[model samples]
Target: MTVQFTPDRLAHRDDPEVSKITAISLSGTNTERVMHIVVDLLDELGPQTPAELEHVYRSRAAVNDWPVVAFYSVHKRVSQMKKHIGIVAGTGVREGGAERVQLTTDPLKAHGKITAHMQGGDE
Candidate 1:
């Protein structure tokens, strides 16, 4: 089966997940920043552990003039993006194995959509 993605499909009002993801309330708490960083890192560095993500976030935050984000906060934002936005996908292991996260769709397209939404623009 093929899934078709279009502006109309993405704007479907009945899809609660999409609505939540596209909501114009992502400006605070570094949520949008984390999303961009995670997606960009996944594209450039491939799947990364939560620890690696925290390190990268700190580094990038300094360079980008954004506030430092905690690992738990990063994990929570990633979890929300995965569950509500479907931009990220990963598996959880309970036996002390590091979780790996990667982008589920085209990185550039996903980033653009997320950035636009975060900036209060309907994409």
Candidate 2:
């Protein structure tokens, strides 16, 4: 699918901090794990600004297996998440210079009930 984002959205996402967090979430060369975390993140926050979402995810207890460096490059992680898990994401410009990222997939389907159950209600 064609990824869409406004110029303003791209500019905000290009922020170094955002990119860094994405990187950490996508590390470990494990697509399933990366997809799991991204979906879990969405489940918890619904939708959120990149910074807020990143902070919550990086600090979560469930992410113990997530790679540390993955938190350093959110941009790259986003790309990988989409490529592997069929998650389409969009960026929106919010008030006060914030950027939001939300999943384009339906949450129930995105979570893969089997795995989500294994993760203990993370979905």
Tens-place lDDT per residue, model 1, 26-101, is: 3343567677778888788877776677777777777777656443556656665677677877755322476787
lDDT of each: 0.64, 0.52
TM per candidate comes to: 0.60, 0.49
- Candidate 2 per-residue C-alpha lDDT over 10-105 given as tens digits, one digit per residue, 9 for 90 to 100: 223455765544433442334345456767787767766655656765676354766454543444445544544456465664734665667777
Task: Choose the strongest candidate by TM-score.
Answer: 1
Instruction: Give RMSD to native, each candidate.
Output: 8.8, 9.8
**Residue 104 lDDT, candidate 1, scale 0-100:** 82
Candidate 2 at 13: error in angstroms?
17
Residue 41 CA error for candidate 1 (Å)? 1.1
